[model samples]
Target: MEKKIRFVNGEQVQTIGVFAGSETLRGYRRDVATITTTGIDYAQAVALFTDGAKWSIVEVGEEQKEKVYDWSSHGVAGPITDNRDGTLIIKMGKNNTVEQDLQDKVDTARQETAQAQAVTEALAGQGVATVEAAQAMRMMIENAAALLPDSEAAAVPSLSKSWVVGEAVKPGDRRYYAPTGRLYKVREGQGHTTQADWTPDKTPAMWVVIDIAHAGTQDDPIPAAKGMEYEYGKYYSDPDDGKTYLCKRIGEADGGKIVLHYLPHDLIGQYFEEA
Candidate 1:
């Protein structure tokens, strides 16, 4: 007789054959179903026989089940495939969050790099080679007249006073004396209150005459003097040479005053022609 055995939690199966009335079989020979344990907790065994068959029990140990992943809960709408070894392969679509974040970072970096390159090129066009050179140029342009004297003191306004008695004066101070119709600068280190009969023209030691006539003008330029502040773009007459010069640059002197550096006569042709 043929018999079949079924078990729950079972994986592999084997088959055996038995003969009746054999000398090796003793007593009542009946077909019996036996199973080998494989360390799994199985349910009760059941056997089905065609005529005379018996049943047998098999005990096995328990095992842990594999974990399954829920892709939808993690905002993953991609197609996933299992490699059957606790790993997965996923194909990300166009709207993937991770890819979009990385692309945004790359775009920001490119924009910053382009801006820096533009600044470098602009500075190079102005003959500035490095960032430090550019910064120094900016500082000089901003504070070009910082070392010069105050504008109020340097400027000879239209209405000015003449040297009078008991009038206070300091170094670099200028006063228009009505008698001579000329401007005079207080001599260096000569700071004191004026006294009677101490007029500017009479006391050459206390005051230095700046101009014989009036303030500088385009047509009648005044001679540039020491301890005098010359303004940019103004016209002045050079003392050494009688040629009228445009104040191209103002430089700092020993006592924090501005000195004038005129353009050379040869270079004047390059900047201005006969016209």
Candidate 2:
């Protein structure tokens, strides 16, 4: 490789060697630099001082090359290369720079890998797949978070009360009535009914809430309980009519009973009212 001077930030700097030194086997020149540091591991690009020459170590190598600069960078010391194994063979450079440069590259790569793995793990936690997909999902989430107000963004909304009327009765589910202030521990989930006319008060066969309001209709027979957990901005499959609904608010039934207010999930932005 032919040795030429390099420039950095629009300033004229020395051009020590192209790929450094000289090789008789193959005279292929490359625009690269090497540096060696002892004990200290340099992970990123940084300024190095040696023999009144300030060099910016760009690449780090694990082997020896006297006349070959592995990579090139624009800096005060012109072009420099970093070698990791012991010392680097430069025309007139020290192994100190090489060590530091190699260490820096290794450390930087390790850190980047760690960060990528962390992101992947987080995405996996959310059931997202693939690195690219995870990244896209994360970007979307970040954008969404940025759009929300500080209080809203920072605060994670959660329902302290877990019981939902429509949810299938599970052994661990709690059966509670705010009006009566009664909490019942459902032993066997089977045959316990909590639906209207078939509520725990009536059937107690299955801990299921019967939707008496929409009973015997095409709507979902299951009734949602008061104070059931619901998430805003999420699509919920309404058992009624097998249609999807978007929960809008926690409202009340005819008797001021807690219920979820929802709209058709596929509804577009428009005005509508009762005739």
TM per candidate comes to 0.23, 0.21
Which digits, one per residue and each the tens of the lDDT, describe model 1 over residues 36-82?
22212222111221122222222232453322221121221223334
Top-TM-score candidate index: 1
Cα lDDT for residue 99, model 1?
A: 44
Error of model 1, residue 8, in angstroms: 99
Question: lDDT per residue, candidate 2, 1-275, as tens digits?
Answer: 22322223332223333344322211223222333333222322233333334333233234543233322332223233356753322332433344456778999999998887776677457545566887676566655544554334324211113234554565544444444333333445363434545444333334323222222222332222332333333333443344544333344222222223333333323211111
lDDT of each: 0.45, 0.37
Give me the displacement of residue 190 in model 2, in angstroms.
61
lDDT of 2 at 112: 100
* Candidate 1, pairs of clashing residues: 39-61
